[model samples]
Target: MPEVLIEAVQPGSPDTGAVAHYGDPVREQRTLEGAAGLVDRSHRGIIAIPGEDRLSWLHSLTTQHLTDLRPGEGSELLVLSPHGHVEHHAVLTDDGTTTWLDTEPGTAPALLDFLNRMRFLMRVEPADVTADWALLSLVGPEARIPGIELDPPKVAPVPGAKFASADVAPRPTTVYSTAPLPGGGWARRMAYGYDLLVPRSRVAAVADELAVPWAGIWAFEALRVAARRPRYRLETDHRTIPAEVGWTADAVHLDKGCYRGQETIARVHNLGRPPRRLVLLHLDGVSTDELPAPGTAVSTADGRDVGFVGTAVRHHELGMIALAIVKRNVGDDEQLRVGVSAAAIDIP
Candidate 1:
């Protein structure tokens, strides 16, 4: 991993944590936007759920319409605490025999435990298989990678970009769920591209052979921030509600049956606003001199603290932008400051 993303570091650029780019951040980002690029998403967790009642049992435990989910279908499910806070989110793809749950890297343990605890009289079996399975993603203009093919399920779009496209048709990338692996595999049209779940032993071979630019953690962070996608710990916490972070529309089903936190979800959607709202902050200028990091305190004019930056990135197009969860009353046109910076950020 270090050999590709770090040891071959680019001078003058920060090369850390499987880094943002193999060498060039902007080039990598452009190829990712205009053409295609392959990324190592092995850091994400994979949980295998198998049992006779796998779909139904899981359908009743989380937010989503999974009871009737088909073998090759895909959807995002949120595990909310009984109080309605987002506890976990799993990108799902079922393969007839088992349901594959792609979780946040460090969250599989607790999610697995929660699933186990809720299995009192059910026949469901959940296993944290991240160690056995490796994940990889391909993003950009191209779709339908070779050796794998599955009709794209009508899933959520890429939330459409903020400073880009208006229509959300055709999807960000095509699906690739079918594979000819002897060891079995999985894939989905998720994230901003197609994600493949293959045997761990095969990850390196596939990664090395991809004919596309490589994007490390940093590049992906920028795109994710541009996409305005929020994760468990970064834009979420113990008290964070799905509605607050915009997960309500993508992951929650309003007409669905009961689940752990349905009451709170209903109460908020029907009668009240989430205590907070997710916003995209286009920082004042092109000065990357003092880029704000996550957890950087946010405030109003003249020093009134308002919110904290959830995720910040030097976007390929948007320069510096951030995803923030601010109080619901924070107006969309409200002028805000990041940390003590004099430049007021815009909620674009």
Candidate 2:
């Protein structure tokens, strides 16, 4: 069924573009977890890197080991500050000729600038292609769409890892599956899905043709929070590091050689723990109308601030919930508060 047009609302984050829902968020989320639901992600940015030296050059700069990356394989990586702060995150796939980067909206400019400045003598050329390309996400139990051949590769589990490697299938539209949460297994509760890259002109037509229901960012955020998936913008700040939110398993390759932030990552992983860790907050009495906004202060029961809320929503089944990064010492069983409402923390 086609989505009836509705007023766009902010999705609780400043970086996130307006468009909270496409009619019904709760039902849309149900569709996403069952069969499939098409989400319009045109606001997402795309960058194309074309050249023989692309992979090697990228491998030298980011947290992932990309030199051996196979065409059509999906993987995520992070660009961090010298102090190990997460500056950028991208889910990328390489075709034989060009490597495509899918990044959050408004991130392409900075990423493109960084890439361009570092191109010293490499053959690679990176360009923003958001104008020519758009993203449509088909999320649910199976990544099925009509008239497309999608064979998601079998992903081997990484025992006791924090995140799993992303898997993908080769296709013209370029489909990549999200890695299942908690690293090494699959669960119906996790919104494991695929992202499809289509031409800017065809996104609307493609969304219209999909037989499944349509979802908005609101539904996506709720599922993401429930899965404890940390978004680039919402879950990070000036001092954020990959270890804080379990991004190391999926985005960082410990065996890889030097990168800008490798020193800090190595030190933290080997010698100590990150100052903060990500957690899922069950908002005790929060209703849809009373959902805590992102950046709301999270404090101990006695009123000592520890962290801030990242994303919060009234889930269809889980009532109200959120994702937050708190001090590493915060006890798992401790009572927490988001503003005036009490919240219970679940370490993800």
Candidate 3:
């Protein structure tokens, strides 16, 4: 397991945990809904693939159309085993010389090893870049900074800037090179030479300058729940497939040439259906005061197991909602009990 780091950003907020090495959970949660807030994700893995054969080498290994990725363009992708089980989900981009693979912590080393072992005679080279760069994620409506343009799943760089759009998830994400800061700071190395990430001791100063409030993991969890996005540990595992989670819509390109798991993915898409489907669950008479644990089972009235909750949250406006992977036959209007300990919930 990766080492978890937790920091307190505000004066009176409770300490929260993170898988990444740095971040202030209190401020992150608060900044999720209204203003922009930054979260330190430096602990996530980053692998740089360099050489002219970079695109071709990667395109042959993973899902998604990577051969045509422009220097500033980005996309969400998945790496799967020959049997079609997900190895990792990642956001990949190129700075012209090298392709960057940003994914969950503890995944980079294995990915790099696999690439190295498979590089028969390819002119590509893979190197870990996590330590050399800092990752700062901005959320909220106002978090949009001046020099960046929102392109949904792409972040366009301002003209004449060294910054490139860092693609994260299936949504827009940007990454800036930070080897050029005046004091050798990571933020200065960004393509735009602007400080998008702040030092741990100076996080507040950066937040104030950006006019965004600090946010916490709780708020992020709520926002992700509202959006129906799946998290790695909470909603997915080795058993999960792209079709079952709805990630196949953006993560995998059906028309792309063969890759390791192409056969299985194709078979599943054309001849087989996912055993379960992801759905939104709206709890009845539940409030923020009573938060249910993820993975709580959902059963039919007679106690037949139908599904399990993936993620749950107490939204300010929506009360309690959850994302669940239920049997395909489950009806949307069906009412089900949430495990043996929790209350009943209805599919929304």
Q: Which candidate wins on lDDT? A: 2
TM-score of each: 0.85, 0.85, 0.73
lDDT of 3 by residue, 260-308 (tens): 8888777777655777778777776433345456677888887888888
Error of 3 at 287 (Å): 11
lDDT of 2 by residue, 205-309 (tens): 666666677787778777888888898878888899998998876677765668998988877876557999999989888433487777889999899999999
Q: After superposition, how far is residue 161 of candidate 3 from its true place, in Å?
A: 42
Higher-scoring candidate on lDDT, 1 or 3: 1
Residue-level lDDT for 255 in candidate 2? 54
- Overall lDDT per candidate, in order of appearance: 0.72, 0.75, 0.61
List candidate 2 stretches off by more than 4 Å: 1-8, 15-18, 147-191, 286-289
Off by over 4 Å in 1: 1-17, 147-183, 208-210, 285-288, 342-348
lDDT order, best first, reads: 2, 1, 3
* Better candidate number, 2 or 3, judged by TM-score: 2
Question: Model 3 RMSD to the real structure?
Answer: 8.6
